[model samples]
Target chain A: SQTIHQWPATLVQPVGSPLSLECTVEGTSNPNLYWYRQAAGRGLQLLFYSVGIGQISSEVPQNLSASRPQDRQFILSSKKLLLSDSGFYLCVGTRFSYEQYFGPGTRLTVT
Target chain B: SQQGEEDPQALSIQEGENATMNCSYKTSINNLQWYRQNSGRGLVHLILIRSNEREKHSGRLRVTLDTSKKSSSLLITASRAADTASYFCAVTDSWGKFQFGAGTQVVVTP
Candidate 1:
Protein backbone atom coordinates (compact mmCIF):
# COMPACT_ATOMS: atom_id res chain seq x y z
CA SER A 1 0.00 0.00 0.00
CA GLN A 2 1.25 3.47 -0.85
CA THR A 3 0.69 6.37 1.51
CA ILE A 4 0.87 9.98 0.41
CA HIS A 5 1.66 12.69 2.93
CA GLN A 6 1.02 16.40 2.38
CA TRP A 7 2.00 19.16 4.70
CA PRO A 8 0.28 22.37 5.88
CA ALA A 9 -3.19 20.96 5.37
CA THR A 10 -4.55 24.50 5.25
CA LEU A 11 -2.84 27.64 4.02
CA VAL A 12 -3.80 31.30 3.66
CA GLN A 13 -1.57 33.48 1.58
CA PRO A 14 -1.77 36.99 0.21
CA VAL A 15 -1.61 37.87 -3.45
CA GLY A 16 1.92 38.12 -4.85
CA SER A 17 3.27 35.93 -2.05
CA PRO A 18 5.18 32.73 -2.80
CA LEU A 19 3.76 29.28 -2.23
CA SER A 20 5.21 25.86 -1.67
CA LEU A 21 3.31 22.63 -1.03
CA GLU A 22 5.02 19.29 -0.46
CA CYS A 23 3.96 15.70 -1.06
CA THR A 24 5.81 12.52 -0.24
CA VAL A 25 4.98 8.91 -1.00
CA GLU A 26 5.80 5.86 1.04
CA GLY A 27 5.93 2.11 0.25
CA THR A 28 6.55 2.77 -3.44
CA SER A 29 9.54 3.58 -5.56
CA ASN A 30 9.69 5.34 -8.91
CA PRO A 31 5.97 5.82 -8.84
CA ASN A 32 4.10 8.32 -10.94
CA LEU A 33 3.14 11.43 -9.00
CA TYR A 34 0.45 13.93 -9.90
CA TRP A 35 -0.68 17.40 -8.77
CA TYR A 36 -4.31 18.43 -9.08
CA ARG A 37 -6.37 21.49 -8.25
CA GLN A 38 -10.09 21.51 -7.60
CA ALA A 39 -12.14 24.63 -7.35
CA ALA A 40 -15.05 24.81 -4.97
CA GLY A 41 -17.61 22.22 -6.02
CA ARG A 42 -15.79 21.43 -9.25
CA GLY A 43 -13.82 18.57 -10.72
CA LEU A 44 -10.06 18.20 -10.55
CA GLN A 45 -7.70 19.80 -13.03
CA LEU A 46 -4.38 18.12 -13.54
CA LEU A 47 -1.67 20.70 -12.99
CA PHE A 48 1.44 18.59 -13.29
CA TYR A 49 2.73 15.02 -13.27
CA SER A 50 6.16 13.52 -12.77
CA VAL A 51 7.31 10.13 -13.95
CA GLY A 52 10.83 10.37 -12.58
CA ILE A 53 13.34 12.64 -10.97
CA GLY A 54 13.82 15.97 -12.74
CA GLN A 55 11.04 15.09 -15.19
CA ILE A 56 7.81 17.05 -14.94
CA SER A 57 4.92 17.42 -17.32
CA SER A 58 2.41 20.25 -17.15
CA GLU A 59 -1.07 19.40 -18.27
CA VAL A 60 -2.34 23.00 -18.17
CA PRO A 61 -0.34 26.16 -18.41
CA GLN A 62 -0.84 27.91 -15.11
CA ASN A 63 0.90 29.84 -12.35
CA LEU A 64 1.99 26.62 -10.68
CA SER A 65 4.99 24.36 -11.20
CA ALA A 66 6.02 20.93 -9.94
CA SER A 67 9.33 19.29 -9.14
CA ARG A 68 10.41 15.80 -8.18
CA PRO A 69 13.69 15.94 -6.37
CA GLN A 70 13.67 12.31 -5.26
CA ASP A 71 11.87 9.15 -6.21
CA ARG A 72 9.18 9.60 -3.54
CA GLN A 73 9.13 13.35 -3.09
CA PHE A 74 7.09 15.73 -5.22
CA ILE A 75 6.68 19.43 -4.65
CA LEU A 76 4.36 22.14 -5.99
CA SER A 77 5.68 25.68 -6.12
CA SER A 78 4.66 29.12 -7.24
CA LYS A 79 6.77 32.19 -7.60
CA LYS A 80 3.81 34.42 -6.83
CA LEU A 81 0.28 33.69 -5.80
CA LEU A 82 -2.83 34.70 -7.66
CA LEU A 83 -6.35 35.09 -6.33
CA SER A 84 -7.55 32.57 -8.88
CA ASP A 85 -5.10 30.04 -7.52
CA SER A 86 -7.17 29.48 -4.42
CA GLY A 87 -8.46 25.95 -4.42
CA PHE A 88 -7.98 22.51 -2.94
CA TYR A 89 -4.72 20.89 -4.04
CA LEU A 90 -4.28 17.15 -4.14
CA CYS A 91 -1.29 14.88 -4.54
CA VAL A 92 -1.61 11.41 -6.00
CA GLY A 93 0.74 8.48 -6.31
CA THR A 94 0.46 5.34 -8.36
CA ARG A 95 2.58 2.47 -9.54
CA PHE A 96 1.70 0.36 -12.58
CA SER A 97 -1.94 0.01 -11.56
CA TYR A 98 -4.87 2.06 -12.63
CA GLU A 99 -5.62 2.84 -9.01
CA GLN A 100 -4.32 6.15 -7.61
CA TYR A 101 -3.81 6.86 -3.93
CA PHE A 102 -4.53 10.45 -2.96
CA GLY A 103 -3.28 12.55 -0.12
CA PRO A 104 -5.55 14.27 2.39
CA GLY A 105 -5.04 17.45 0.36
CA THR A 106 -4.26 21.07 1.17
CA ARG A 107 -6.79 23.84 1.23
CA LEU A 108 -5.26 26.99 -0.23
CA THR A 109 -6.97 30.31 0.18
CA VAL A 110 -5.40 33.24 -1.59
CA THR A 111 -6.47 36.47 0.00
CA SER B 1 -10.40 19.46 -22.34
CA GLN B 2 -12.05 16.84 -20.15
CA GLN B 3 -12.68 13.44 -21.66
CA GLY B 4 -15.49 12.37 -19.33
CA GLU B 5 -18.72 14.22 -18.63
CA GLU B 6 -21.23 13.18 -16.01
CA ASP B 7 -24.95 13.74 -16.40
CA PRO B 8 -27.32 15.10 -13.76
CA GLN B 9 -24.77 17.43 -12.22
CA ALA B 10 -26.70 17.04 -8.96
CA LEU B 11 -29.03 14.45 -7.50
CA SER B 12 -31.29 14.47 -4.46
CA ILE B 13 -32.68 11.21 -3.13
CA GLN B 14 -34.15 9.86 0.05
CA GLU B 15 -32.59 7.16 2.13
CA GLY B 16 -33.33 3.55 1.13
CA GLU B 17 -33.70 4.65 -2.50
CA ASN B 18 -31.32 4.01 -5.34
CA ALA B 19 -29.18 6.68 -6.99
CA THR B 20 -27.86 6.40 -10.50
CA MET B 21 -25.45 8.62 -12.43
CA ASN B 22 -24.23 8.41 -15.99
CA CYS B 23 -20.87 9.29 -17.52
CA SER B 24 -20.00 9.72 -21.16
CA TYR B 25 -16.57 9.93 -22.70
CA LYS B 26 -15.17 11.09 -26.01
CA THR B 27 -12.24 8.74 -26.83
CA SER B 28 -11.16 5.15 -26.37
CA ILE B 29 -10.10 4.20 -22.90
CA ASN B 30 -8.30 1.40 -21.15
CA ASN B 31 -10.41 1.59 -17.99
CA LEU B 32 -12.98 3.72 -16.21
CA GLN B 33 -13.17 4.28 -12.48
CA TRP B 34 -15.60 5.84 -10.00
CA TYR B 35 -14.61 7.76 -6.92
CA ARG B 36 -16.33 9.36 -3.95
CA GLN B 37 -15.35 12.51 -2.14
CA ASN B 38 -16.86 13.90 0.99
CA SER B 39 -16.87 17.60 1.79
CA GLY B 40 -13.38 19.05 2.08
CA ARG B 41 -11.65 15.71 1.61
CA GLY B 42 -9.67 13.68 -0.84
CA LEU B 43 -11.34 11.33 -3.27
CA VAL B 44 -11.63 7.64 -2.45
CA HIS B 45 -11.66 5.01 -5.17
CA LEU B 46 -15.02 3.26 -5.33
CA ILE B 47 -14.90 0.92 -8.33
CA LEU B 48 -13.30 0.33 -11.70
CA ILE B 49 -14.66 -1.28 -14.86
CA ARG B 50 -12.47 -2.26 -17.77
CA SER B 51 -13.30 -1.78 -21.42
CA ASN B 52 -14.04 -5.47 -21.94
CA GLU B 53 -16.40 -5.77 -18.98
CA ARG B 54 -20.09 -5.06 -19.06
CA GLU B 55 -21.07 -4.88 -15.40
CA LYS B 56 -19.47 -5.11 -11.96
CA HIS B 57 -20.84 -5.11 -8.45
CA SER B 58 -19.25 -4.10 -5.17
CA GLY B 59 -21.52 -4.33 -2.18
CA ARG B 60 -24.30 -1.79 -2.77
CA LEU B 61 -22.61 -0.24 -5.79
CA ARG B 62 -23.18 -1.40 -9.37
CA VAL B 63 -21.24 -0.21 -12.43
CA THR B 64 -22.11 -0.78 -16.08
CA LEU B 65 -19.85 -0.04 -18.99
CA ASP B 66 -20.56 0.11 -22.73
CA THR B 67 -17.56 0.51 -24.96
CA SER B 68 -19.62 0.98 -28.11
CA LYS B 69 -21.50 3.82 -26.45
CA LYS B 70 -18.43 5.22 -24.80
CA SER B 71 -20.34 5.60 -21.58
CA SER B 72 -20.83 4.13 -18.11
CA SER B 73 -23.37 4.20 -15.31
CA LEU B 74 -23.07 3.88 -11.55
CA LEU B 75 -25.93 2.73 -9.37
CA ILE B 76 -25.98 2.94 -5.61
CA THR B 77 -28.59 0.70 -4.04
CA ALA B 78 -30.40 1.43 -0.78
CA SER B 79 -28.51 4.59 -0.27
CA ARG B 80 -27.74 6.00 3.17
CA ALA B 81 -26.90 9.42 4.47
CA ALA B 82 -23.29 8.34 4.51
CA ASP B 83 -23.48 8.01 0.76
CA THR B 84 -24.15 11.70 0.35
CA ALA B 85 -21.11 12.95 -1.48
CA SER B 86 -19.73 13.96 -4.83
CA TYR B 87 -19.18 11.08 -7.23
CA PHE B 88 -16.73 11.42 -10.08
CA CYS B 89 -16.03 9.28 -13.12
CA ALA B 90 -12.50 9.08 -14.44
CA VAL B 91 -11.48 7.59 -17.76
CA THR B 92 -8.02 6.25 -18.31
CA ASP B 93 -6.68 6.54 -21.82
CA SER B 94 -4.55 3.93 -23.53
CA TRP B 95 -1.52 5.79 -22.28
CA GLY B 96 -2.76 5.39 -18.67
CA LYS B 97 -3.51 9.09 -18.20
CA PHE B 98 -6.77 9.67 -16.35
CA GLN B 99 -9.25 12.45 -17.09
CA PHE B 100 -12.00 13.20 -14.58
CA GLY B 101 -15.53 14.44 -15.06
CA ALA B 102 -17.14 17.34 -13.27
CA GLY B 103 -18.89 14.86 -10.92
CA THR B 104 -22.44 14.37 -9.66
CA GLN B 105 -23.37 15.69 -6.25
CA VAL B 106 -25.61 13.12 -4.59
CA VAL B 107 -27.46 14.19 -1.49
CA VAL B 108 -29.14 11.40 0.41
CA THR B 109 -31.63 12.75 2.86
CA PRO B 110 -32.75 10.84 5.91
Candidate 2:
Protein backbone atom coordinates (compact mmCIF):
# COMPACT_ATOMS: atom_id res chain seq x y z
CA SER A 1 0.00 0.00 0.00
CA GLN A 2 1.13 3.52 -0.75
CA THR A 3 0.92 6.37 1.75
CA ILE A 4 1.75 10.06 1.73
CA HIS A 5 3.17 12.10 4.61
CA GLN A 6 3.30 15.88 5.04
CA TRP A 7 5.24 17.74 7.67
CA PRO A 8 4.51 20.73 9.95
CA ALA A 9 0.81 19.94 9.83
CA THR A 10 0.23 23.52 10.91
CA LEU A 11 2.43 26.57 10.65
CA VAL A 12 2.26 30.22 11.65
CA GLN A 13 4.56 32.60 9.83
CA PRO A 14 5.17 36.34 9.61
CA VAL A 15 4.87 38.26 6.36
CA GLY A 16 7.85 38.13 3.97
CA SER A 17 9.18 35.01 5.71
CA PRO A 18 10.42 32.04 3.74
CA LEU A 19 8.28 28.88 3.72
CA SER A 20 8.85 25.23 2.94
CA LEU A 21 6.37 22.34 3.07
CA GLU A 22 7.49 18.80 2.35
CA CYS A 23 5.58 15.82 0.97
CA THR A 24 6.89 12.28 0.55
CA VAL A 25 5.18 9.19 -0.81
CA GLU A 26 6.15 5.76 0.35
CA GLY A 27 5.88 2.65 -1.86
CA THR A 28 5.55 4.44 -5.16
CA SER A 29 7.99 5.53 -7.88
CA ASN A 30 7.62 7.98 -10.77
CA PRO A 31 4.20 8.88 -9.46
CA ASN A 32 2.42 12.07 -10.46
CA LEU A 33 2.51 14.67 -7.68
CA TYR A 34 0.38 17.78 -7.26
CA TRP A 35 -0.04 20.68 -4.87
CA TYR A 36 -3.38 22.30 -4.25
CA ARG A 37 -4.59 25.08 -1.99
CA GLN A 38 -8.06 25.61 -0.63
CA ALA A 39 -9.39 28.86 0.70
CA ALA A 40 -12.13 28.95 3.31
CA GLY A 41 -15.49 28.05 1.72
CA ARG A 42 -13.85 27.92 -1.73
CA GLY A 43 -12.87 25.18 -4.13
CA LEU A 44 -9.37 23.80 -4.41
CA GLN A 45 -6.89 25.73 -6.52
CA LEU A 46 -4.13 23.78 -8.21
CA LEU A 47 -0.82 25.48 -7.57
CA PHE A 48 1.67 23.09 -9.16
CA TYR A 49 2.19 19.55 -10.42
CA SER A 50 5.20 17.39 -11.22
CA VAL A 51 5.34 14.59 -13.78
CA GLY A 52 8.94 13.56 -13.05
CA ILE A 53 12.05 14.59 -11.24
CA GLY A 54 13.25 18.12 -12.10
CA GLN A 55 9.99 18.78 -13.94
CA ILE A 56 7.43 21.10 -12.39
CA SER A 57 4.30 22.68 -13.82
CA SER A 58 2.74 25.80 -12.30
CA GLU A 59 -1.01 25.91 -12.63
CA VAL A 60 -1.46 29.32 -11.13
CA PRO A 61 0.94 32.20 -10.85
CA GLN A 62 1.80 33.10 -7.30
CA ASN A 63 4.60 33.55 -4.82
CA LEU A 64 4.70 29.81 -4.20
CA SER A 65 6.65 27.26 -6.25
CA ALA A 66 6.94 23.48 -6.26
CA SER A 67 9.81 21.07 -6.95
CA ARG A 68 10.22 17.34 -7.13
CA PRO A 69 13.76 16.76 -5.94
CA GLN A 70 13.47 12.99 -5.73
CA ASP A 71 11.08 10.55 -7.35
CA ARG A 72 9.07 10.25 -4.11
CA GLN A 73 9.75 13.67 -2.60
CA PHE A 74 7.84 16.85 -3.57
CA ILE A 75 8.16 20.24 -1.98
CA LEU A 76 6.34 23.59 -2.03
CA SER A 77 8.33 26.70 -1.24
CA SER A 78 8.17 30.45 -1.23
CA LYS A 79 10.86 33.04 -0.93
CA LYS A 80 8.49 35.52 0.73
CA LEU A 81 5.04 34.80 2.13
CA LEU A 82 2.08 37.04 1.59
CA LEU A 83 -1.09 37.41 3.62
CA SER A 84 -3.06 36.07 0.65
CA ASP A 85 -0.79 33.03 0.55
CA SER A 86 -2.43 31.62 3.66
CA GLY A 87 -4.59 28.59 3.06
CA PHE A 88 -4.80 24.83 3.51
CA TYR A 89 -2.16 23.23 1.27
CA LEU A 90 -2.54 19.66 0.07
CA CYS A 91 -0.11 17.20 -1.54
CA VAL A 92 -1.44 14.43 -3.72
CA GLY A 93 0.09 11.50 -5.64
CA THR A 94 -1.45 9.50 -8.45
CA ARG A 95 -0.53 6.31 -10.27
CA PHE A 96 -1.91 4.15 -13.12
CA SER A 97 -5.18 6.05 -13.42
CA TYR A 98 -6.14 9.68 -12.82
CA GLU A 99 -7.38 8.94 -9.31
CA GLN A 100 -5.36 10.98 -6.82
CA TYR A 101 -4.46 10.03 -3.27
CA PHE A 102 -4.15 13.06 -1.05
CA GLY A 103 -2.20 13.73 2.12
CA PRO A 104 -3.73 15.14 5.32
CA GLY A 105 -2.66 18.65 4.26
CA THR A 106 -0.87 21.52 6.05
CA ARG A 107 -2.68 24.59 7.27
CA LEU A 108 -0.48 27.65 6.73
CA THR A 109 -1.29 30.88 8.49
CA VAL A 110 0.56 33.96 7.34
CA THR A 111 0.21 36.83 9.79
CA SER B 1 -12.98 30.61 -15.50
CA GLN B 2 -13.33 27.10 -14.09
CA GLN B 3 -13.45 23.96 -16.18
CA GLY B 4 -15.79 22.07 -13.90
CA GLU B 5 -18.90 23.68 -12.39
CA GLU B 6 -21.22 21.97 -9.95
CA ASP B 7 -24.82 22.93 -9.41
CA PRO B 8 -26.40 23.74 -6.03
CA GLN B 9 -23.53 25.00 -3.95
CA ALA B 10 -25.14 23.55 -0.80
CA LEU B 11 -27.61 20.81 0.04
CA SER B 12 -29.26 19.76 3.31
CA ILE B 13 -31.07 16.52 3.79
CA GLN B 14 -32.35 14.22 6.50
CA GLU B 15 -30.62 10.97 7.18
CA GLY B 16 -31.59 8.02 4.94
CA GLU B 17 -32.60 10.33 2.17
CA ASN B 18 -30.70 10.31 -1.10
CA ALA B 19 -28.50 13.21 -2.19
CA THR B 20 -27.42 13.96 -5.74
CA MET B 21 -24.90 16.46 -7.06
CA ASN B 22 -24.35 17.48 -10.67
CA CYS B 23 -21.28 18.75 -12.46
CA SER B 24 -20.74 20.15 -15.95
CA TYR B 25 -17.52 20.76 -17.80
CA LYS B 26 -16.69 22.98 -20.75
CA THR B 27 -14.20 20.93 -22.75
CA SER B 28 -13.58 17.29 -23.56
CA ILE B 29 -12.11 15.05 -20.91
CA ASN B 30 -10.43 11.68 -20.75
CA ASN B 31 -12.01 10.88 -17.39
CA LEU B 32 -14.04 12.40 -14.58
CA GLN B 33 -13.62 11.80 -10.84
CA TRP B 34 -15.54 12.58 -7.68
CA TYR B 35 -14.00 13.31 -4.31
CA ARG B 36 -15.20 13.98 -0.77
CA GLN B 37 -13.56 16.17 1.79
CA ASN B 38 -14.29 16.57 5.46
CA SER B 39 -13.74 20.01 6.85
CA GLY B 40 -10.05 20.89 7.08
CA ARG B 41 -8.89 17.64 5.51
CA GLY B 42 -7.52 16.33 2.25
CA LEU B 43 -9.91 15.12 -0.41
CA VAL B 44 -10.78 11.42 -0.49
CA HIS B 45 -11.45 9.80 -3.85
CA LEU B 46 -14.97 8.51 -4.20
CA ILE B 47 -15.27 7.17 -7.74
CA LEU B 48 -14.09 7.58 -11.31
CA ILE B 49 -16.22 7.26 -14.44
CA ARG B 50 -14.41 6.95 -17.72
CA SER B 51 -15.49 8.74 -20.88
CA ASN B 52 -16.52 5.54 -22.61
CA GLU B 53 -18.71 4.41 -19.70
CA ARG B 54 -22.08 5.83 -18.84
CA GLU B 55 -22.93 4.66 -15.31
CA LYS B 56 -21.04 3.05 -12.44
CA HIS B 57 -21.94 1.98 -8.92
CA SER B 58 -20.00 1.22 -5.79
CA GLY B 59 -21.77 0.29 -2.60
CA ARG B 60 -24.35 3.06 -2.07
CA LEU B 61 -22.68 5.44 -4.52
CA ARG B 62 -23.78 5.80 -8.15
CA VAL B 63 -22.21 7.94 -10.87
CA THR B 64 -23.48 8.84 -14.32
CA LEU B 65 -21.77 10.60 -17.14
CA ASP B 66 -22.95 12.28 -20.38
CA THR B 67 -20.09 13.12 -22.69
CA SER B 68 -22.41 14.89 -25.11
CA LYS B 69 -23.40 17.34 -22.41
CA LYS B 70 -20.01 17.14 -20.77
CA SER B 71 -21.73 16.55 -17.44
CA SER B 72 -21.83 14.00 -14.65
CA SER B 73 -23.94 13.27 -11.58
CA LEU B 74 -23.18 11.57 -8.29
CA LEU B 75 -25.91 10.01 -6.14
CA ILE B 76 -25.53 8.84 -2.56
CA THR B 77 -28.26 6.56 -1.33
CA ALA B 78 -29.46 6.22 2.28
CA SER B 79 -27.31 9.02 3.44
CA ARG B 80 -26.10 9.18 7.00
CA ALA B 81 -24.88 11.93 9.30
CA ALA B 82 -21.36 10.73 8.65
CA ASP B 83 -21.93 11.43 4.95
CA THR B 84 -21.82 15.14 5.62
CA ALA B 85 -18.92 16.54 3.60
CA SER B 86 -18.03 18.64 0.60
CA TYR B 87 -18.14 16.80 -2.72
CA PHE B 88 -16.03 17.94 -5.64
CA CYS B 89 -15.98 16.87 -9.27
CA ALA B 90 -12.62 16.92 -11.02
CA VAL B 91 -12.20 16.77 -14.79
CA THR B 92 -9.04 15.31 -16.29
CA ASP B 93 -8.72 16.93 -19.67
CA SER B 94 -6.66 15.72 -22.58
CA TRP B 95 -3.88 17.80 -21.08
CA GLY B 96 -3.96 15.55 -17.99
CA LYS B 97 -4.22 18.49 -15.60
CA PHE B 98 -7.17 17.76 -13.36
CA GLN B 99 -9.44 20.73 -12.71
CA PHE B 100 -11.93 20.78 -9.83
CA GLY B 101 -15.29 22.43 -9.38
CA ALA B 102 -16.43 24.82 -6.68
CA GLY B 103 -18.01 21.75 -5.01
CA THR B 104 -21.29 20.98 -3.31
CA GLN B 105 -21.39 21.07 0.46
CA VAL B 106 -23.66 18.30 1.72
CA VAL B 107 -25.01 18.33 5.25
CA VAL B 108 -26.81 15.22 6.40
CA THR B 109 -28.74 15.75 9.61
CA PRO B 110 -29.59 12.85 11.80
Total backbone collisions for each predicted model: 0, 0
Candidate 1, chain B, TM-score (2 decimals): 0.98
Candidate 1 Cα misplacement greater than 4 A, ranges: none
lDDT of 1 by residue, A20-62 (tens): 9999999888888888899998888878888899999998888
- Model 2 regions lying over 4 Å from their true place: none
For candidate 1, what is the TM-score? Answer: 0.93
DockQ measured for candidate 2: 0.53
Residues A8-87, candidate 2: write the lDDT tens digits.
89999999999999999998788888888998878888888888999998888888988898999999999999999999
Chain A superposition TM-score per model = 0.97, 0.96
Evaluated with lDDT, which candidate comes out highest? 1
Q: Model 1, range B1-110, lDDT digits (tens) per residue? A: 66789989999999999999999999889889999999868788899998889999999999999999999999999999999999999888776677788899999999
Q: What does candidate 2's lDDT look like per residue over B1-110, in tens digits? A: 46789988999999999999999999889899999999867778899999999999999999999999999999999999999999999988876667788899999999
